[model samples]
Target: MPSLVAPLMSAGCLAGAPQPSLPVEGGLLLRPWRLADAAAVVRVFQDPDIQRWHLKRADTEAEAREWITRWQQGWQDEVAAHWTVVDADSDAVLGRVSLQSIILMGGQAEISYWTAPWARGAGVCSRAVTAVAGWALSEAGFHRLELGHSVVNPASCRVAVKAGFTQEGIRHNALLHTDGWHDMHLHACVR
Candidate 1:
């Protein structure tokens, strides 16, 4: 019988990857999510702005804990890297940022983020995203990082721009929110 192992090995299908580490950006620290963050996650998701954009709601502590667990699993699976955006000085949870849909073989990933209500209007998301993008491009050796947001969310668009992501174009009817399908503005940054 012909061996399949030779083909797989030649294709680089068995390459090992490294785990991601927490990144610090001045006042903000991008650290792994913990069960202790459940309360903060619940509170942040309860905000109307977060609910309107993200669609997924975590109203209870249990659901928030589950969300944290999923992030942990994503790390183990090498599919995503999620960070709880926290204030370095106070260690207070300010929001979250993630490098999702990570394809190490392709050297690309997508970024997503949300800021706590109290943390909004202060460029928290923008700074956090910029730091993560720098890490992804330089340390992680990723060539491209993408971000998209509902066109209706101008705030997110501004964040993307401030973080150095170039606006690419619109994806028509890309996201399905509670209201309905909405167009999304695609953005990207290249190393």
Candidate 2:
């Protein structure tokens, strides 16, 4: 039997158009990843803090290329969208921001990000999140966007709040990192 609810967004609403490069406050812009970014990708993943926050690491240029392939495929499949946050003037990557687990029919997605070691403590991640959230809510037509972070990471909590996502609650043992399972603080914003 079919459910009574209507989907908030159309299936092709996102994939129908090319992904956009968003220029936010600060000197950052969110642009699609390229294979040429392989070296930078590997370098960023080598950071201990990045590895701790995001389990996987790209050790080689080939591995970074594969990651880029997946990100591009995700956009075509309309399942997710990944953007490399870069210096708008120089086009050098400062970090990355992504809309993961996108459900276009439901008008919802989850946001994730990591900053390059050099960009840390300079508010790059928060600025990227703010840019992506604004686009997802206003232009892309998503009804809600969620940001989840391990409760142990206060920095992510600060980023989420600074990006305007309200803390909803915690999910018990929601994420499994290399250390062990962790409770996640769930934050969200609705259009």
Candidate 3:
């Protein structure tokens, strides 16, 4: 029998990816999460609106620290990437974005993001999404990037569209939020 592992290992996939800070338009940058960001992470996850959609809450600084550590682990494992959206000039934490469930062999990944409550309605998430997705496609060599949100989340749908993802369809009862099972609107962008 042939060695299946050989082919996969030789694919030059994201086996040991490096996390790099990427600059975006409008004086914003996407950088790796830091331990010092625990306070902001806790604050963002504490918001009822964010918790409602995310279905998880980081109530304490310890929990927030764990969240950042998990992203660091993801980078070490080369399975995902997480970035903290910050103002380039002021260095203020504006939001968070991630390319999760990454499968480098398949050249695919899922994108997710949440904007700080104070940053919402200012197009921060949309701009961050565009920058991250473009980087994942062009720089990272991902062939397809996908994102989905509860169908009730028109704001997220708008952000996905604005970031160049095309709506594929709705998946029934695809995600369970705090409210209950939600139908998710799937969107994707292909390179």
Candidate 4:
């Protein structure tokens, strides 16, 4: 064997390196965002519900391509790690989960998640959150995970609670939602 290292690297696998895929239950996998996912990404942003909560405007086709490009740049910048929640059986995109504002000095990370409107109530966000939190705590070496949601959004608060986060406190006008600035409930989990 003339050192298969080069071939392995080119193929995107190597011993002692991080595995690319994150396996979840029910045949779903959370993985890196792909440029080819622009269509689905646009669909997500086009959703009025997602737009309301995420505080984003509907994206045009050109803007959707730019969105995917930004996603790639985000990973490249170490500013955030974003994942696409995919169905294990059909490989359909179920949602998104991410760790943003990763702070090594404070050993903390901010967690965010969203599921397709159709995937609501199926525990998809919860599962995806658990996986991401585990990765941040263990693999990413984060000691604390923080989550925040507008107090008006009880569904999101419930998701955070279900993911083992402790309700910290309300931050007045913490978030500027589509409606306006709103009180946000902060949650944190220490590993």
Among these predicted structures, which one has the highest TM-score? 2
Q: What does candidate 3's lDDT look like per residue over 67-177, in tens digits?
A: 899998887776788999999998899999999998766678899999999899989999999999998888778889999999999999999999999999999999888
lDDT of each: 0.85, 0.92, 0.88, 0.77
Instruction: Point out the higher-scoring one by TM-score: 2 or 4.
Output: 2
Ten residues in a row with the worst lDDT in model 3?
3-12
Assess candidate 4 and give its lDDT.
Answer: 0.77
Off by over 4 Å in 2: 1-3
Per-residue lDDT tens digits for candidate 4, residues 104-177, read 45566699999888788899998889888887777656679999999988989988998899998999988887
- In the order shown, the candidates' Cα RMSDs to the true structure are 4.0, 1.0, 2.2, 7.9
Poorest 10 consecutive residues of model 4 by lDDT? 7-16
So what's the TM-score on candidate 1? 0.89
lDDT of 2 at 57: 89
* Candidate 3 ranges with C-alpha deviation above 4 Å: 1-17
Task: Please tell me which model should have the higher lDDT, number 2 or number 3.
Answer: 2
lDDT of 3: 0.88
Using all chains and alpha carbons, the TM-scores for the candidates as numbered come to: 0.89, 0.97, 0.93, 0.85
lDDT of 2 by residue, 113-137 (tens): 9889998998999999999999989
- What's each prediction's clash count? 0, 0, 0, 1
- Candidate number achieving the greatest lDDT relative to the actual structure: 2
